[model samples]
Target: MPYPLNHWLATVGFGLAFCILASGNRLRAEEVDFVRDIRPLLAQKCFTCHGPDEGTRESGLRLDLADGLFGELESGAQGIVPSDPQQSELYQRLVADEDLRMPPLDSGQRLTSDQIGLIRRWIEQGASYRSHWSFEPLDPTPPAEVEAEDWVENQVDRFVLAKLAREGIAVSPAAPPQTLVRRLYFDLIGLPPTAEQVDAFVADRDPNAYEQWVDRLLASPAFGEHWARRWLDLARYADSDGDLGDKLRPNAFGYRDWVIQAINADMPFDQFTIEQIAGDLLPQATLAQKTATGFHRNGLKNTEAGSDQELDRVVRTVDRISTVGSVWLGLTVGCAECHSHKFDPLSHRQFFQMYAFFDNVEDVDLKTGHGKVTVATIAETKQRRETFVHLRGDFRQPGEKVRPAAPEFLHAFEPRSGKPDRLDFAYWLVDGDNPLTARTTVNRYWMHLFGRGLVDTVDNLGVSGEAPTHPRLLDWLAQELMRQGWSRKRLIKLIVMSATYRQSSQPRADLVDRDPQNRLLARQARFRLDAEGVRDVALRTSGLLDHRIGGPSVRPALSADITAYSRNRDWVVSEGGDRYRRGMYILYRRATPYPMLQIFDAPDTTASCARRDRSNSPLQALTLLNDPVFVECAQHAACYSDWQTDVDWIPQAFRRFLSRDPSAAELARLRVFYDHQRQTLAEFTEAQVRALCGESFAVASADQHDLREQAARYLIYRCLLNLDETITRE
Candidate 1:
């Protein structure tokens, strides 16, 4: 049977109050911010018919630009008249008759009354238009002081508290020591803290106890293991060449290990990016540097019997351009591949210009360790290939040739030579003047720490993307990242040490009607663990995890049905200890993924995944109770220590799985459940007991009392692991 929904919900404290609190009751800011308020509305509703694309723009009017919006329309009428809603054709048509509406009768789109009012108020306020929030350079001005000086721990807290003060919402108090320690462990190392570690932290009297723990975890090798999974998702790192045949990429793990090592070493962000983009082009490049170039080769490839090889190469090139655009610049440049972007400033010619940098690179398997191992990497071709605009994104319809360069809308790209290459492009990406890279990078790390980023839409920071909830805070953090020598560890340490990150995640009844999404950062966010993180927690708690550092990927045991999906059908489960490695080392076959990981929302690795979807489904509950790995975890965790010898087994189990002691009522109810399960197990047959408890329980004993008690304890452990709190990170 699936785990009881009510039982899980009750444990996690996400009942009716949470549902009502999550209702859509968002309150707008007192003063209208042009980028935050007006741009999104224009981009979503007005821009489609009157924005960027010249071909589809109606009446030769562009609402996206100020000159266009304030200029006379084709009908010789002012499109927008500042401070006069009465004279503005924009506002006039918005409230016009159905037949003469701005969107027209057949457009099937209409501005709501509230929206129309906002436009009127905006016009009455001078119809201001600011540059897109993300395009502007980082603001060097320090954060403004907040009234709640006592609550501030750092600049991050100052910004958050200032926002909360403006919203008339009080910041939630600092989380309890128990909650903080567990949250820090999971956030930093992606593992649960042992009971002893939790006890020590709680008992420590030193004021630097929390900061010390942060330093220790950041220094731990596990930090790399935990953080690399996030980058690999954006890199689309996979074990197989994804397509119908699904052939394996044997040397892919070399790049994966390089990332782990680089992050563990706290490699500067600028150098990290430079190496991956054009490491092989560096003078006297080392083997490790060449492996870093594998970032470009992680995309899908086709090697079928009948295929368009040239087109396949072109597709890979397109993937490279799109990946760089999304990962570094946070722009949807792919939209401009066939035509000019209808939202952002990316143009068709500019997209090809960016593509030209990657066009000359070709994949090569580099031999390492005296030819015993191969690393998948890229190198510049002996004869560079010219880049042409793929007319309508079709390789057969090539248009004008373009030279390598950065987007014109961004900072100038000055190559060292007359002909620029990937190396020059890499330098261009990390250049101080490029607005997107530092901000986008800082946002990525922020999203991983908090449940959401400062800018909620992480992948897109263009005009259409959501504006930063705290624009000043975002810029402050970005500036700090660059000033600190681009050290990710230092930035992460600074964030976790901040009072803003350490706030209790409990829902506020007062803010229920005000801040539904918690964009104001009145409290920290509570969310479920990432899919791989869920498995890592189970393995670590069960004492089955191999904490060894990086190496080649391993094939964990999969059901025959899952294995059948692979073309080779040669999945041999790793021997003994290798089977218990962390989920990061699991072979990510694109066509045939590991069942448990995929069920928990693991990305398929076909494209850049900025953020993963966290889903709650009955299948997830069922998997925890029935899947072989999780079942084994429950049995081992329960039977690892002698439960019968301990009177406080329930409390012990709670700490082991949840890193906390149960409440009086929670302990009482769990004890009753244990007693009921003992009685149920007493009547079960030996075969049935063995099936439920596994070999770890030793059900063959002549003493039936022991079997009953062991089976009951095993079931309780399963129950604990299945609770919503077990997988959730509060």
Candidate 2:
């Protein structure tokens, strides 16, 4: 049966009243800040039609800019009149007739009365404008004080606690040592701790035990393997060229390995970004840098008969533009392709300007056949090419010529004397003044550690994206990234060490109603393990894992039916230890991913995927029970230790699988299960026993009794592995 949902709800409900009573002190209305309160409201309600795009600017009014908002509109009325809501055209339109609403009746956006009141109060208190919170230069301000000063362990905790205090929400206490250690292991290395390791940490009296554990895990090679999976999602890393035939890119594994190595070496984040974007363009670039350019080569390529090659090339360029925007800038710059960005500050011209940086990459047609990486390494030509705006995102319909440039919205980092190239464009991204890169990078890292980001819409931090729940906290992290010289490891360590990150995942009863999403950071989030992590945990617990780091992607056993999708290629399952490599090394065919990973929500790798969906289904349970690999794991785990009695075995099994000993009640239920399975195995016929043992039953009839005993043990192990807690990271 599925884990009971009400169990968590009941816990959350118990904490609600206490939270409200504790956080009763609220901020007054007069202290409203424009960047925090007003800009978000205006960006959501008015920016789409009136702010950025000149072509789409309605009635020659722009609320995004101070000059535009305070100046008279084409209708000879100021959008905002200082200290007078009656005279402010913007305020009047918000409360205007339904047909004459500022967003208009059909726009599907309407300001609530409370929101209108906030806007009115702002105008009444001398209307002021500030740069968009994300675009402003990051300020390294100390965290604001909170009532729970004793709870603060770092600046992160201070920010989190300050927000919770304002919301009248009390922070959840630190999770138990056992739970904290397990959480740290999975969060850092994407693997569960061994029972001995877990016990040692729990018993350690050292105050810095957790920090030491975190540092050790961070330094482990596995750290790169865990984080590389995240970067692969953004890189759209794949083993095959995605199309009807599902052709393979054998050397794509080179780029995957590079990522793992780069992360493991703790390469500065700024250099990491630069290398991936224009590594080949670097003067006297190393082989590693050239391989880094494989990020661009990771995009899907079409080689089907009679395909439009020119159009396909344009699509590839656009893919790079869109992916870079989402991965680095946290904006959907692609939205401005056809016209102008309706909601963001990017213009149609600016979109092409960014596109121009990637336009000059020499197109190479290297498709030999399926299962081969044609151009494993990228080579950029020194020759430059002019780019034109595709009038409606159509290559044939060219409009205006454009030079390479960053988006104009940031108002930072313009090209020097001559036209900037890809390297210059990349340098500009990390040049300290550009606001979105640091914030976007840190936000994604935060999301990987926590279940949610400070800004919920990780890929889109523009006007249309969800406003940050803790804007100041997000800025603090962004500034820290730059201050630490863009060292991803340092930033990650700072976040993980915070007391806020150490909070218990268990929710207070009151939190369910007030902060259902846990946006206020009242508690840590408990989520099911990612597809790779789930598989890794089982492998580690069962003693079947191959700890070898990286190499060519392994082709795990897949049924012939699934491999048939690749018409021109055949998959040969890797032999011996290769079959048990980490899931990140599993061969990822875009058209047909490994069935187990696909079912568990692994990205298809057709495009940049910022976050993956976590889904649970009966099929997942069935797969664990019946899949051959999982069955093999269960059988191995069952035979791993020789326990003298059920009492010893059951507790040991719990420790191996869950890093915790079973309770008396759990032991009682498992004892009954073990007894029932043994009883059933004793009655099984010879053929049935052979089927249960599969190919491993090569011994003669003399060992039949021993085989049946092992089969019974397999049944018990399967049950343990399928437990909800076994596959979840709490």
Candidate 3:
């Protein structure tokens, strides 16, 4: 049986204590890796004052590179010497007295005994320093051999099982066929499978039934709708210009449809990147390609009276560059906007260099195939704007003149011509020599499938990001993505086919206490559906979903109190079938959000979202019980069963909502609850029974016994729809 909503959330929220059960054996068996083990420690503790950022360095000491660790300081003392810890100034300062410690008293930093020991051991073992993991080229070596070859399905499994063998843990068995069907449907298309579809898969005797289903779902139109929702979060796609005005963008849905069509066409990711970054600059670009440039126009805009238009443009440019860094490079380049970055190698000038790439574009409207519908997109101007570094990030105070360029620390920026534009910068991002794009993209797909990323910090992969638990696996996937011609569908299909993703999500008794975060990948991860996904599942199950692909975003009904946040102070509910459209097609006003969506933690669309938080609260439960959309769903689902004729309506309801048969104990408990509901309804008058059943239900001439029975069924279906298992991806 599944736990209560709050209990399941506490166990699987992805916010639990992090413990690397798989990497513990490596720490005990091999020498410490400076890049994986030591750099993150020093980068977190010492890099602020002693590393990078020349403005803050004290006493001419640097711990970020090998030269600084071993070189003699201005005071004529070596910070680190080969194979000697006692004499190394770095180690001595760490072990110094409270008053003379390395970080000093006011830095609010202290090293633990274990951390100090790791440093001393590194110095004693020759203090070797290699480049950071994210900066290095992908490792070309084959996957390591594993003893449990029976569990291996693809190269991904070999790497995963090898780690489990080293850690002395058994890999979990595959999940049952019924459970796998539901998992695939939600993971691929963000909907629940019909009961018949689940039964067909469970009864199929063919060996390739799962793979065949995988291919079919990948080709479904709904696949684009599901995947585009994730990309839109990264693009910060919203229907309105955010701020007090909150004016609606009438043509914004055109860009959303463009993304959907591109994914459905299986466009190569490299070409996808080039198109969005500089599609309009392409020679004789088509209308569809120009529409892809809407990625940058999705940033929040401020048109309030007396607001600084110049400052607003600068802010939009900053968001574009920062989003590019996070989405493609996985670096927090925005941290260096005001001053030099304290953690990574990005400098203030480098930030402006990136800013210059997006500085020359102007927003324009492209008239679409639809009558008079125009998409907002960016275009290059005839006149060039001189770029300069902003002093202290202020547009009024210009510092040094700069040009468009990539950060020099990673790869050499090669321009197509001397006068490079955003097109050259886009090519530089996807170049094979660049280490971050492939790795970052691979990790994002992995995070969507698995609950956590190979590097747990999905948005930042600089020195400060978490180390990959399976470093070789990450590199291998990155290499394979390029080898596959950057096909997202093929890569995603490859992942689900692996045995690592097919493992049962049931937690092991031994691992529950030790590996609460499930970083070991001994089994699959189970998590709740995203906010849009949660609503989609309910509408699909109720048989009320309008399966139309795309159009203008619909405005669902909202209460007066909730609609008061809108600029117009009211909402016009969509008519007919549009009222029951998918959650992704709902209008997302920045100032006035849909209460159910906001209560479930939907992104406000004010900034790029890497990962959304999953929280459980009384409000969520209350909304599920009382929200109009869900209440209508319950009414429709309850009507599907014949309360007067069918003796097994209770079992049918279970199969409809959960896509599975209920256990005997569950059936018995639900029967008792149903009986009590009927008894309570029996005491009400006929008019009261009709009022409770809702207007849509036919209760004009209702027999007393049948009215109470139908009302009881409605109450029972509502209880089932609110179940934790109904909303979770298991």
**Alpha carbon deviation, residue 196, candidate 3 (Å):** 0.2
Q: What does candidate 1's lDDT look like per residue over 378-486, in tens digits?
A: 9988997878888888979889999999885678888999988899999999999988999999999999888889898999999888878888888889999999999
* TM-score rank order: 3, 1, 2
In candidate 3 the C-alpha lDDT for residue 252 amounts to 96
Cα lDDT of model 3 by residue, 435-536, tens digit: 899999999899999888988899988887877888899999988888999999999998999999999999888777555677889889888788888888
Per-model CA lDDT versus the true structure: 0.84, 0.80, 0.84
lDDT of 2 by residue, 88-185 (tens): 88789888887777677788778889999998888877876777678777776788877777777789998888777777888888998888989989
Cα deviation in Å at residue 729, candidate 3? Answer: 0.6
Instruction: Give the lDDT of residue 9 in candidate 3.
Output: 31
Each prediction's TM-score against the native?
0.93, 0.91, 0.94
Off by more than 4 A, model 1: 1-21, 45-50, 54-61, 71-79, 86-117, 564-568, 642-644, 695-705
Model 2's C-alpha root-mean-square deviation from the true structure amounts to 5.2
Of 2 and 3, the candidate ahead on TM-score is 3
Rank the candidate models, highest lDDT first.
1, 3, 2
